[model samples]
Target: MTKTQKPLVEDDQVAQYAAEGYFVLEKVIGAEDLELLRGAAQFSIDRLDAAMDAAGVDRIGINAKGKRYFSNMVYQQRPELRRFIFGPIMEQICRRVLGENAFLFWEQYVIKAGDPDTTFAWHQDSGYVHENHTPYLTCWIALDDVTEENGSVYLLPYSRSGIKSYIKHIPIETGDQVCYFGSDPGLPVIVPAGSIVCFSSTVIHRSGANLTDKLRRVYLLQYSPEVIMNGDGTAPHGSYEAFLIDGKVATAVS
Candidate 1:
């Protein structure tokens, strides 16, 4: 019943992730497990759209001059998500890539489709965390097979070493703008279903368009040291605020 009693990480995974900033675990979730998580993601997506509509959240514009963000803390609002989030597969991987002391930051569905370039801009995870520490990892789980044809995530080789110079906001339109972590052309990361990949928050990364007929469904679970604090406990800029699954409001890590 103690922390050390929990399962430990494999040496290979730890070594690989440390050197490359990522490691892919194949078939981490079986079909049943994948289905459960997918169901929650689908339902959450629907409920989110509805909630936004009811709030008169314009499909394109902001309601109060503030930007929009989405994240689900499965341990709270979506217990079903716990099956995927804290599964032995993820727990061990996180404990290895991050440390055993790591905990959730937030989770998001980076759903994308064809022709709508709205691909995530290149940016490091730490750019949002604004923290000066380790364990700020982004675990990307693919719900379906990912391939270059449909816009898999792209990573700039060893970009984490240049974290500060790469994380910057650039204007995409007149006045309206967004952020990019780096400008270097990146290599696309394609993995099979049920596999997971981990990256440091400071690693430059982004996704491409979903050009194929299939939807590029991805679950982004971000985590960091459970005890780390970022400025009076507020969400890092560019990340979504989340609520716990039990309907309790989530506070910042601080």
Candidate 2:
């Protein structure tokens, strides 16, 4: 990198993540990259809508029509998404937060539908896994200018959450696994489009509904030091794809 160009993820931001459990990289994604991600996000939403229509159901697992949508594992089909996924911006953030070796644990396009309004339950990302594992990293990228009203995520830091470790979550009828029922309200993060919120998997977080007129679109990338397998070792819970190894991007990410 040239003298004028700085690292995508700064050392101070990494320090903030260590202290607060999350850090926001504001307006880091470039215009062209943001456009590509926006297009890809729209495509995933459309596909999910069509799938729900064909299935004659508004809900597919945790994805609810006009409320919430989660289109995951698209890189396996949409090659373009891989460009943004493996780009230097993401790789650098993962390298600092998750250490030298980082495996693709999970990826998804999460949309909070507008009008009707939705409220996600407070829970830790690691709570979803049945087995005990080390805390991973979650990179929540905003595809639109996000605010508290536009379905931005609310984070509870380690100090406020008082959760020393991952706890079992109760699965609600809406398919949300809830861990906290307190009235803390959490910290609302507002940022412009193309910002990234790098947080730990053990952090307790949730998002409110999109009270605005448009859908709140976000892309999520998760990484871990090792392959995350199911509790019984039956199968990988998310993915075991090698992306980063020994503090460098993998030569061939397949």
Candidate 3:
């Protein structure tokens, strides 16, 4: 797709994302791409488990109801992951929503196994990092058909207006950190495999436990501009490198 071409995201959809802090787009991934991603996810999961075992670290708490298969910076480990992270459609969406110069900040896979008691507390992505970038876009791609019974994500629309105070960071056995905030009844974001749910980093969101037999696998990519400030209002060291997509360097503003 050319830079000037209008991507799949329509004008109304962009408006919705701006107003509600999130939007769902369907059929962004084709069958072949989905199959490839599934394979990559499995590979990442196995590698992560082995690494954790070697380190004698269990990132998932012992009492945690469900398992979280996680890997940070997965694109570097599994080249296939780059297909989704820097894919044409994804780049288009990021450029359209975040701006033409938006760059990828991070990529991860969060697979929630079928566990009835496993639920994520309500929180905002921005809460975890003390970054000056007010808001960036998080593209959550469903690797499987996600439903309410399988721990689909729930988002609170327009919650960015009244930002909540950050609570303590909770460490999980998966070697990942979760930030907690005041709870709220969020709207469930249900989408089929190959679909993407885009939300702002500041949007309040969470996922419930997977009560069904199906697993809920989601690949998340966060995009931001070149700079991110620390909590002390200083530039963070070793700043996150932004990957350019669609010939545009991801930026904080359009």
Candidate 4:
């Protein structure tokens, strides 16, 4: 909590979240925390690259070597990331949006290489679940300036996308699970580094190729008011760790 930090959420943004299913928290990350995130992202990327090399494969699941990598639970590895994860800004955002005791759902680094091939498919965060599950909140934090040409995100609200609820996605050979195939040309998100673009888990969104010469670095964090369960009631869908209780960040991290 620096003096420069603005009010975490606004009335209009909350209203917009209810209506449009998404909102942007502009430049909310402090400079020091932003650098920590960048460092952690690079650290995770290097580790992923090493794992891929050891396995002797250029591609692992959806992670393409030198193209795109999805590194999960990155905060668990870096102490700085742990501080940022349990810090005030994220707690406030989760409390405001979820409106209940918030649980850590999933956190990851989605790093797209410079000028890679066609990237993420048009899909909802819930679409990945592909089964009945509670919709959670996704906070996509930009580690670098994001723009249309540089493979920033594009979102289609539930009202516009027409696929309002969670739907099963079709798997492709390219490793994308796609749900929406229409040509509506989703709304492009253009924002500077340190901004967080928050959206509902059911909101349809995707990103295109990074045509620029720089990597498009995004760290995504998801939170839910309740601990979501996996399909068939097997187990919790996420880490099921309590981040906030009674609208306050838990003193002891689980």
TM-score of each: 0.73, 0.94, 0.80, 0.94
Residue range 1-254, candidate 1, lDDT tens digits: 25667444457767756665666666667889888767766655565566677877634321111222233553466666766665566556655565545566777765555544545666666655444444467788888899877778887646344443335445443222345533566777778988777776666677666677655677888866544466556544323333232323243321
How far is 107's C-alpha from truth in model 3 (Å)? 0.3
Q: By the lDDT metric, which is better: model 3 or model 4?
A: 4
Per-prediction count of colliding residue pairs?
9, 0, 12, 0
Query: Residue 121 of candidate 4: its Cα lDDT?
Result: 91
- Cα lDDT of all candidates, in order? 0.59, 0.86, 0.71, 0.86
For model 1 the TM-score comes to 0.73
lDDT of 2 by residue, 154-252 (tens): 999888987757888999998999999999999999999999999988899999888998888899999988888888888888888877888878835
RMSD from true fold, candidate 2: 1.7
Q: Relative to the unseen true structure, what is the C-alpha lDDT of residue 187 in candidate 2, on a scale of 0 to 100?
A: 93
Worst 10 residues of 3 by lDDT: 245-254
Supply candidate 2's per-residue lDDT for 24.
Answer: 89
Q: Against the true structure, candidate 3 has what lDDT? A: 0.71
Give the residue spans of candidate 4 off by over 4 A: 1-6, 251-254
